[model samples]
Target chain A: MSTATATRPATPRAELAAEHGLSPSSARPPLPQYLRQVWARRHFITAFATSRTATLYSGARLGQIWQVLTPLMNAGVYYLIFGILFSSRRNIDNFTAFLVTGVFLFTFTQRSVTSGARAISGNLSLIRALHFPRAALPLAFTIVELQQMLVSLAVLGVIVLLTGEPITWAWLLVVPALILQTIFNTGLSLAIARIGARVPDVSQLLPFLTRTWLYMSGVFFSIPQRVHAGPLQDLMMANPATVYIELVRDALIDRHDAPQHAWILAVSWAVVAFCVGFWYFWGAEEKYGRG
Target chain B: MADIQHTNGQVPTVIVDDLHIVYRVYGATVGKGNAPAAFKRILKRQKSPALREVHAVRGVSFTSHRGESIGLIGRNGSGKSTLLRAIAGLLPPTRGAVFTDGQPTLLGVNAALMSDLTGERNIILGCLAMGLTPAQAKERYDDIVEFSGLGEFIDLPMRTYSSGMQQRLRFAIAAVKSHDVLLIDEALATGDADFRKRSEERIRELRDEAGTVFLVSHSLDVVTKTCTRAIWLDQGSIKMDGDAETVVNAYSSATR
Candidate 1:
């Protein structure tokens, strides 16, 4: 009998639940609590990242070697075009070291953003099956890129030493610069993850967008020598990708100096991108996985 | 009034109050809402005609007490699985809410946990994702392996497993931790008889742990065997909710 059901007032049931310390199953935790939850799952996040990194090339015969090979191949192509053909390395010292550093470093951000765009959409099964903080997926994807970049970085170091660059104390600066870049990428990934979830087409659009970013960031050529000094020159130098690449370039190649404000720009970009991206992603904490 | 149903004064572990879930499906039906129609609507600054909304769970309300194994019985498209997902907090309710004493774990039959990873790794990842520390996950690893009965095949990637094997592994991993509210949707239907028997025993153990279990199964026999209470849903509303045998019987007779 439909009448057998007692329709109690909604407020009383809710109040009773609250009295018993029950919370809504679908309620998004406050930002602080959400951060704590994500922090609590750090082990899972790392494990997930490592597992994904390990399996990334499992199907290929070359397997994990591709991590080093892919970037080496990319750097080779850029060197052929920019160093030899286009001669865009004008006034730049140690072009090989410079181009490899830029490619490896910029690939970190590029892969992080591209994979971050697919982090939620790609792992809908994992997202729907588990109850951990959703941010873990994107964070894990970023770590996967970081792991790959580490291998590429090692390869970059070898190429730099081969190019006769001395291991000066300036090389110590690469660590902190990479740390800042990683933080900046983590934030960008988080923001892009949410956007990718909302708009599936973002993943498709990312390749062209990141390609534009790659060229604008001066991955191949020196921006100051090529682009005339103007507001455009200042904007290109201030771009976060260019800032990070310049920091690494200055650290690795003594002659290729970063602008005077590079360190300040790097730190501010990391903090701002992280805060803005995290806030943007967290704002839609409950909206994820919904149809 | 809810206390009347819980004569033993069992605390309520799950309270789904007038919950509603609507799924917004895009690119739905090219009949009237064709691409050109969508283009025209966009040009007219109107909402895309292709965006259709499916009201999946329409005002379903129920209270599950601690230690109760409630079977959700319904025909296809009757919102049984959707209700389970809503209770598990995976789907945001379009209206009302689902309040729980603790987190609800949903185990759908097809909820693949890293198909590329071997069953061994999947167990560890699944346990860790469920908030178990590395040490605790290791402690429960053997028991879960023993329970799953995959034997030598556990080392193989999960994608290599048959559907039944995957379900067993999923059930094993989920059963390792005692959840306050476990929402299982048709996960047990794929298991063989022996596996089913063991899972039934495990379900009883879960109930003795003072947790509420919600099982959505089309098999009335499995429901009558496993659940104390049964809810028969028709068209997203509760057609009947009572003792398992009575509800299953009424549902079967009505359908026949």
Candidate 2:
């Protein structure tokens, strides 16, 4: 314990002022500086994301096996309902592969958005305790979803091969389609993260929204054959989820042909969502930790 | 009471000017007199919920210079933690301003460390969060471990450690880098006597190196012993600010 009671001799305020500059320090840092800070902590961001991914299924009895099992189980249910019961696979060749791709891709976006909404709100204590780039939380959540998707992708490839689709150079197009889908998912994650921090209850409403989107995205059945040509058809085709899912099905399965502008629409939606979502989230950076 | 200003050659590291922090607490209960009206409002499903505004810190102002250890002594809910958080830039000020010469590091107890991770991993994570590169954090790893005294237990998950051990580790990680401004909130309250002594010594060394420290503690004895100056707060306002011994004495007598 420092029990030094004697006060030190006073010094002139002018001399003190001359030695150091004084300015308000609590204001948000400039945009470039903030970007630089985020860039500098890139390693921490990746590590955090990886660690969360590693522990995500730690509590479950099956652990990481669930990652592969989840999407496969969903595909099984969809096949039983749409392929067997409804006979929706009438016109489509290799209907199993098509349904598997649709379910896997659509679920990737759904999981990313739902988990991303909880990113900031879930880590409020971490946000309050330490100073770092707030964007890292949502980015980490997206990475976790991405890691799970990689597992699902492996299973999807095996399913497509087992269904007797010949290996072709066009199969490599799945890579680009996946990359675009990931960007779109990242953007949606960031947008939902900001809203989740504010409303908190938005998370409860997300599942319904994603379910509606999943059905409209042509995951279980072919939208073009079912819906007639009109503004509604155009709107469905324009949806980025539908565009990306259709692109993947076209690339992996030989019978289906994607629209001429599918690639254009996919890339455009990815870039626009990323830019708009990032800007919206950054605008609320300083307000995230407090009410 | 007369205000005591530091006129020493040391530069002012923190200047908190007329700071006011307001908290908007939602779902406030309606009073007895308005029971029927509240029931009617609830039945109609009002768009805006009931809210009560709490003035946590009201127009408190002070200046702290380099090489000074100031203690903020207050009762529960006197806004001591809120004021420290505002200075650290974690909480935006509702009004007024806080100016500082350098970045302020707030020593938050166990809040930043992941419970499932080993103590060693948390040390690395915490260092990275404080803006240290991976290499720099690695370089300081041994020193931080030694300071924390967690030695062999560092390999175990943090959830296995006692709260006191966790707090010590947190303090060790925050103290690894000599900060220009450090805000401590009840960090010393959990540690044992030996740890407290070493923490006080470290604080003195920081002051000697021209660092500024703000300690918010309920223990007046700790304040008088470790801090050179003290500011006593009551009901979100400063009641006294002077020599640590004088303020502590006054505060103790008034409470008794």
Write model 1 residue lDDT over B38-103, tens digit each, in one string: 677778997765678888888877777889999999899999999988888888777777789989
Best by TM-score: 1
How many angstroms is residue A78 displaced in model 1 relative to the true structure, after the best TM-score fit?
1.2
- For residues B1-256, write the lDDT of model 2, one tens digit per residue: 0222454455688877667888888777655437677687779987435677899999887878888899999789999998998888777777666667777888866365787778988888888888889899999999999988888999888889999999899889988888999999999898998888888888888878889989998888788888999998888888898889999999898989
Per-model tally of clashing residue pairs: 0, 2
DockQ of each: 0.53, 0.37
lDDT of 2 by residue, A1-291 (tens): 001101223223322433567545555566788778788888788778777776777779998889888999999999999999999998888899999999999999999999999999988878877778888888888888989999999999999999999878899999999999999998889999999999998989998999999989888788888999999989988898899999999999988899879999999999999888877888778778774
lDDT for A178 in candidate 2 is: 93
Q: What fraction of the true interface contacts does model 2 reproduce? A: 0.53
Off by over 4 Å in 1: A1-10, B1-8, B32-41
Q: Locate the minimum summed-lDDT window of 10 residues in model 1 chain A.
A: A1-10
Q: How well does model 1 score by local distance difference test?
A: 0.89
lDDT of 1 by residue, A1-291 (tens): 111122335555666676678778876788999999999898899989988987899889999889889999999999999899999877788889989999999999999999999999898888778788899999999999999988998899999999998899999999999999999999999999999999999998999999999999988888988899999999999999999999999999978899989999999999999999888898887767763
